[model samples]
Target: MAQSPGDGPKRVAIIGSSGGNLHSHGGDDPARLLADIARQLDAAGIELAAVQFVAAQSSMDHASDDTAATLWTLEPAGPAPTAQGSLSEVNETAGEHDERLAQSLRSGEIDGLILVSADPSGTNGKAVAAAAEVRAPASGTGGTSLATAQALGVDLVAGSGTTGTTSATRAVSYVSGLARRWGLKYRPVIGSGPSTVAEGSPWRRISIRGIMVGSIPAFIAMALVLAISKIPGLDFLSPVFDTLMEGLPIVVAAVAARRVSGLGEVGLVAGAVAGILSAQGGILGGLVGGVLAGVLASYLLTWTLAHRFPATTANIVTGGLAGLLGGLVVHFALAPLTSAIGDGVKTGIEALVEFNPLLAGAVAGLVMWPAIIGGVYHAVILPLVLVEMGEKGHSFFGAIDMVGLVMVSLGITLANVVLPRSSGERALAASGAAVNFGFGTFVEAAYPFLFADKRVFAGALLSAAAGGALVGWTGSEATAYLPAFVPPFIATNKLGMALAMVVACACAFAVTALANLHHRRKQRA
Candidate 1:
């Protein structure tokens, strides 16, 4: 049953039917579909309470493993939705199980439900009846659920050929709309989706977003500790700030390892040990060591499991050995190689800035988004930025990024807020703009618009190039992550930096507004 507006967070359950099978449609797997639903619900300010697997048979063996796996994947996205623990016994008949589920829903134990079943005929009649009894929306991959939804007059049903994702999206949209109509209060969260690279890439498990997210705590701790220590009475806290900053590598390593290995406490311990040993090589070294250790540990665990080794023994030995080996490898071999490469890249960038600041800035700015799109930003650019920050107090290249990339992205998002064709787009753009301005570390808020149209992408590049050129000509550098507007005040050439920001932002805003206008007109036609 639906809760009233004053009720706390609305709880939802995902019911995956045992006999049903959801196949990959258009390169999106079932797990991805589930994750997408979670993201959309997060955006809609709804709570995904739990995922329940139901089987008609009187045995647990009939439950869908696919659904269980999907739940596992959703864990890393944010908070893991609870699994139904008080479900009926495996020996219970289908009718008994359905009754228990219905009791939960009817009693407001579960506020809403999303039913996923690929086969039209496979949806449990009892479950459908239960949802109908509560006037809950029915959504799925086939006509059976569609008929139920149509009868409910919800218009939230996906077509017969539609994927589970399509159904989930429509259902979430309807719920969100209903909430809005009822004047219900729900706060939308940003960055609820897992910040993972696409599947199939070896490093797909190495969430670049996770790395950045994990560093936030350390950054905050340092900021607070440093600020407090500056007080005359609290000067002793200064060393605490240094110690906290030094622990950042360990934090990053543990996060990276967990994202990659998914191994519980063992992974964290291994990653921390590997990270501490490789700290001499810098944060990059810790990251590399952690990832390497995670990979080896995962492989070893897999092998041990196949050989019938004890789980505890296998995990301990593999984790310990992997950490030591990974740390040693980085310290002895990769450290020197990475240091030399970092120096060389730094030298090349310096020479480019020296030769022609304007051209260098333009080139850097122009390629920023492209490199991000091509996945080079994570593998190449970020490491170099870290290198520069470690050696010099400020980074010239990073300065261009602020003026060109960050500012341009902000400009495009701000334009969307002014001239968005849809309320959803406008709201998202507004949020994106706020987040971008606040963090200045991420530009993902602009991704929807950038990926939606090539014109926007091109406009962003050109705008960023203009800004980068100005930054180069002025020789401004940035030392910290702050709003794009704030960089100029701290820059060597404040006036030039300001000019560059204005030009880039203005150009991007104009280009995006024009592109949006064209798109809106095209849609009307």
Candidate 2:
């Protein structure tokens, strides 16, 4: 409960404030930084709460394809420069600094706040300064640069406009100093970036224009659309080619991707197609589609190259294909249904925008769960957050727009429910949790309780369906702050909005229990 930064006696969790570092993919400095921080915290006998990191940056013109610079900020839970990262690879992967670490943060559970590696400035410093100058437009130039940054805060500010090493060093100094003045307690770890400072990999950042421009709000508006979509004539998503076609490029590319099992021209072509659709939506959509096409095609190609392609690569490949297909359905079939609902309760639905906290909390809780909650959290909250002050993906609106969360969430939750309590279950839970937490950002806590009994899936699946239906019915926008690479629409309060899920859980529990009992009785007979 110690509130000050660098306070003693607490577990320190290091939060990565930046994205992939393109500089040296061979050497994982950021990951080292995280481990080092964890070691220090553990050594201190204090627990690390959560690490808040921000990788915000800016570019001069929208057209320049050069590296976009970043302002990487890491929040640790102890003293500055107080014994950070290990020099070994054992402490590198993500699991070491998760959950137990994050949970500590949520409850005011930290004893100290340590600042680790707060690097500033980059090649794009000039452009960033220019952007900052015009950040508010009417605000004028009285420290417009600093003022813009101050108001934008660490979460919102990006220091990617620097020209080279010198400016980057200067900017990092200014940022670190300003942060300390603002009480951020960081180590100011300056590194080299042709484009920007990186947390780990250089290729992980997303172009967030679409969701940043109101994806959550837009999708919240769309959630209403989902509700109405349930109405026969109101569903606009059903008959449209967009919803289903959304998955097409991936499907088509899957064929070629699977052919070579490598990130061939087909994969790049898929990426291009997705990029086009995203540009159509704005940077938000572009980032989502582009990332998906890149990752999927790239991964498949890797597998193809290794000559160890999965026999079921087809299923995995089709999953991406299914996304566009689902989109087409939502646009063409389900969309009109929403219109019908809207017509009936247009006034009522419109009046429901009070930003209900209970609903928000529940949705947030769902998002906080292991699978969809934590894994995909990056994708879910990124669009809205812009920074952990910003680290995440799809955001809120991006969440609802993409059908991926649903597919992934269902896979995860169901896996939790259906799998027996064995090493397989444990592995499934781990994978599911990681996917939802690391990649999808959907739900988190539910897995444990649901897994308490196998019958839990019936309730879990039913609840998941209800939640999905609620989202679909409401047309709630989801992709905002984060990028899932596969496109996402989960939100911060996503946990709260998944209310219908309660009933689904109840249904699943009932069905599962009854079936179990029935099987038992038959055995007795």
Best by TM-score: 1
In the range 135-232, model 1's lDDT, one tens digit per residue, is 65543443455565556443332233232223232233334433454455532221123542133122456766566555545544554465456567
- What local lDDT score does residue 448 receive in model 1, on the 0 to 100 scale? 91
Q: In lDDT terms, how accurate is model 1?
A: 0.61
Assess every candidate by TM-score: 0.52, 0.24
Clashing pairs in 1: none
Model 2 lDDT tens row, 356-417: 52353234424433434334544544433322111122233243323333333444444444
lDDT (Cα atoms) of all candidates against the true structure = 0.61, 0.34
